[model samples]
Structures are given as C-alpha cells and as structure tokens.
Target: MTSQRAPLEPLVPHPRAPVVPQASIIPPPPLPPPAPASGPAPPHVFGLEKSHLLKEALEKAGPVPSGREDVKRLLKLHKDRFRNDLQWILFCAELPSLIQEGPQCGLVALWMASTLLVPPDGVPLDRLLQVALERGYTAQGEMFSVADMGKLAQEVLGCHTELLCGGLGGPNRDYILQHIIAGHPLLVPYDEDFNHEPCQRRGHKAHWAVSAGVLLGVVAVPSLGYAEDPELAGLFHPVPSTPYQPPPLPEEGFSGAIYLLSKQGKSWHYQLWEYGQVQESNLQLTDFAPSRAMDGRAYVVPAGGVRSGLCGQALLLRQHDTSH
Candidate 1:
C-alpha cells in the first residue's frame, strides 16, 4: 500500500541515491552541485587530522573535551580510507542523520536510513506512517514493535531485515557489530529508563538509533543538524533549535564523531559527543512523548555480553538480494 497524501514539503533526495522498488516513493531529483570555492569549507574538514601539528596537539591535549580533542580518534579510523580531504567531506555529506519528531523516532530513524540506497528519497515517511496505521504497528505513536517495523521494511521498502539479540558486553554484542561490519545498517532500541541497568530488556521507555557502519573500535551513526539546518529545517519540523555547533578548525574531518541529542529545559541541543561508550545514566526522552505500548510486551533477549540490548534492541535492515 502507498500513501496517497504527500508530505507538506518535497523531499530532496541525495545525489545518486536510487528509489526503492516496492513503495510509491516519489523523492524529487537531486539538485546540481554548487560552484567550486563558492563558500567556506564545511566543519568536518577541520574535524579530522591532516597534519603532524594536529597529532602533537591532540596528544598533549587534556581530556576536558574542547570538542577539538574529540576529533583526534575519529580521524585515526577513517582518514586513511578516503583519497583526499574533499572526498572525505563528500562522504560525510551523504550520511543521514535526521532529527526525530515526537514518538516518531523509530519512523524517522528508519526513514533516515532508507536514503542509504540509490535514491533521492528512500522510503517516504508517509508510507511508513500509513502502513503502521493500517497494521496497528504505530501503537499510539510509540512505533513500539521492532519486529513489526522490520515487516514494514519487507512490505514497503523491499528490504531484508533480521532481528538479533546481542547482549550488552563482549562477544554477545559482537553479533550485532558483525552485521554492521558486513555492511548492514542497524535500527536499535534501548530504554532511556534502563540505560544504566546492565540486565533489563524492558521494552517500555525506548528510543531507536540508526547505525550505518562499524569498525576500528567505533561505529558510524551520523546524526544531528537536520532540524537545525536552515535548508533542511522545513522537512525536519516540530523540532526545537540548538546552538551547539562544532568549533571551526582546518582541513581534517571528524570520522567517528557522533552528535548526542539531548534536551534542555524547553528545546533540544546537539552536544558534540560519542555514543560508543556505555551509558551511566538515562537519556531525556520527555520530548519524544511516552507511550506505554511496549510495556509488558514480549521481546528478544540474546546471550553473551549478558547485558546485550545496551545498544538498544538490535534490528538489522538491508535491501533484498535479488541476484537469483
């Protein structure tokens, strides 16, 4: 089933991104590139390390986290993978990290991830919303079931999704990473309420995070700036604004850097931080609007790390392999 109603704004798909075959996704065509040297370089160019001076500066730098020191480790992992700084900049630009709208975090994350394939718009948000409403997966806007969400991918986007219960520790958690390392993007759920508890799978109070690639002891989950960016703000609506922007540097870009989405008294802020580290406290989910749909629901609990799901309940999604 396709969504007959269109979004308020037209989605501008990334260049070379192809549409999914199953859904009635009608993403607008990619726009032309800007003129060369027309403006200042992006923040990521300075987020990486391109010189010996930076390496020395990073080593002597204290861990107070001036935001620049945070850049050192991320650069070490991906700097060698790309040919030049410009190429790395382009690669980072293509990565998706849209902000969440209410309890639509799961939907926004899955929708954000759909852009990874060849198409401007991946799976339309309306299509996912429509299917969820029809199939009762929406669960009062909680978008509660990962299994049902996976089915949405199969039915609407023609993707192959797998559910893995990777425990929260060594070895067991490795199972989830194995797929990401194998190039599968993951949609994981973890309760903000149980973030500090190492052994609970309570589906109540959860949020979805998208992981694109993992390697070198770090995972790439691009996020932040979607709702804040002036150009993209219209599409990522109803989101509070943030003034948290990275301090400008030189040419190197931040490869593994992650923007932590947290809330202030009234608005949300994007702190320049890493999500790779295990949590010590709860994330503020008041903005997402709590729905107790996942309460008392049966969910998967995999063995190994003994505390898996620390990265949230892991759900892997990929395009169907049609090469038969």
Candidate 2:
C-alpha cells in the first residue's frame, strides 16, 4: 500500500500582522538655550592696604648701578647669598644685544607668564614670536614696549594682560606685590646695561627677566624666584650659580614697566596689577629715590575677559609715550 502523503497546508495570512503607526507631522520640542559663560569681575586691590607701605618700599629701593664696575661689585657682594637664599632662579637665554630675534624681552616675558600660569593650552615661545610678528608688535623691534608684547599676549592667549610702569618707588609697587602673592609671575624690564648682569651679553637698551616668585620674609634678592619651594632648593639650570640683584630702585623718571596678565575667575572678576621701568640715570646714581616716571600708569592691552576679545576697544591706544 502506498504511504499517505501529508496534505499541503493551504496558504493563510497570520491573524496578528504587525501594526504600522501612521507618521506624525508634529516636530520635536526645541532644545534649551546654553548657559551664559562666566566672566572676570571688577578689579580689586590685594595684599597691602596702606599707601605708606608702598612709599617705604620705594624709599628702600636703592638705585641699581650700571657701570661694569658697580655691577661686578654688586654681584661679588651677593654671589654666595643668592645661591643660598633663592630656591631657584631664571634667566633668559636671549640677550637683546646678542639675539637677532628682535627686541624679545617682552616675548620672553610672555613665555614666562605662560609657564607660570601653567595653562594646559599655553603656547610655546617660538609660537608666541610668530603670533607677535604677525600682529605687528615687533614692528618697532627692540624699541617695542613690554606693553606691546603684553597686548600681543592678550590676543594670543585670550586673556587680559598689561604693562605697568614704575620702579621701587613707583605708584604701582603695592599692586605688583599683590599679584605676586596671588601667584602671577611679573615680566620686569630693566636697563639691560645697569640692572641685569652676568649674562653672556649686556646692552644699553632694556632687558626682560621673569620675577618668578616673591620671598615672603627672606629677602636675599628681588621679587622673582625660579623654584617655588625652599626645601627643593638648587641652582637654576640655565643660569647656574648666577647672582640676581634687582637694580637699585629705578630713578625718578623711568620708561619701562612690569608685564602683567589678568586672570579670569569662574565668574566675572578681575584683579589689577603694576610697577615701573629702568632709567639711564639709575645706572649712575646709587642714592637717588625711585623716579616719578615710575609713578605714571600704562595700559597696553587694556584687559581681555572671559569672552574672547572683550578688551578690543581698550587696545585702540597701542603705543604709549613710554620714554620717561
């Protein structure tokens, strides 16, 4: 007998076919607006409160001698002490007289500031030089004020930075001390011939050095330091065994100023900063008071804030009559 073949199942649609929803024409709700960015607040004074304290600092700021003989004497007097006192020191490798890289004290200062602030995205010195050159800051070459360099930095770094004029007795002495305490390195311009010495080369024009830090009570040198902690003391690698003594207080009328950069807070808030330049007269005199020129104020970058280029209007006045 032939086996019965299985009957073929008749075709039938499933009772539960997948349902298809009709497409809606309504649009999704719009996203919420972004939160506004916080910016620097108003400028305020920090550290010293009394004006007389600044006056005393000015009076005590002795004149720095420039003659090769005086510089040798000063270094001789302080050599052993500098190594013993400061935790570390910094000296620029480029000297204005020797370097063909244009007047680069300001550029060096910008590098120091970038290093000190330790910004995660800080630019390198060569990049800074390129940006500065592109920005026309180096047009005047070495004659360009530290203020101009500061302006260039403000743009490149996207922050507020400025140049403050005066010396030991200058009006902004108090202000300079305040920022240092707040952990800002100062770009000090001094008569390269008179104030800065022991460099491979020295010149009649101004030179820049970074005031890396300030010693609270132990005063062996001026406001800057290379190493932050006293316990980790060692000679600065670049300028090993070199003695750094700030020239005596600047003369009554000085031309250069300290380079300062403004810091942005989580919100709107800014700090003010200053100091003055070195004078040719300071090289000759040892007993003269801080110059009146140091008292004059100079603002090269005005001030950039949280938002980029906020201080654009302030920078319209680029060159200052810095020849004090």
Worst 10 residues of 2 by lDDT: 305-314
> Candidate 1 regions off by >4 Å?
1-94, 166-172, 193-204, 215-312, 322-324
Per-residue alpha-carbon lDDT of candidate 2 for residues 138-208, written as tens digits (9 for 90 to 100): 42223124445555555665544544432233344544544454345555444343323311121233344
Q: How many clashing pairs per prediction, in order?
A: 16, 20
lDDT of all predictions: 0.39, 0.33
Candidate 2 lDDT score relative to the true structure: 0.33
Structural similarity to truth (TM-score) of each candidate: 0.44, 0.37
Q: On a 0 to 100 scale, what is the lDDT of residue 209 in model 2?
A: 46
> In candidate 2, how many clashes are counted?
20
Residue 190 CA displacement from its true place in model 1, Å: 1.3
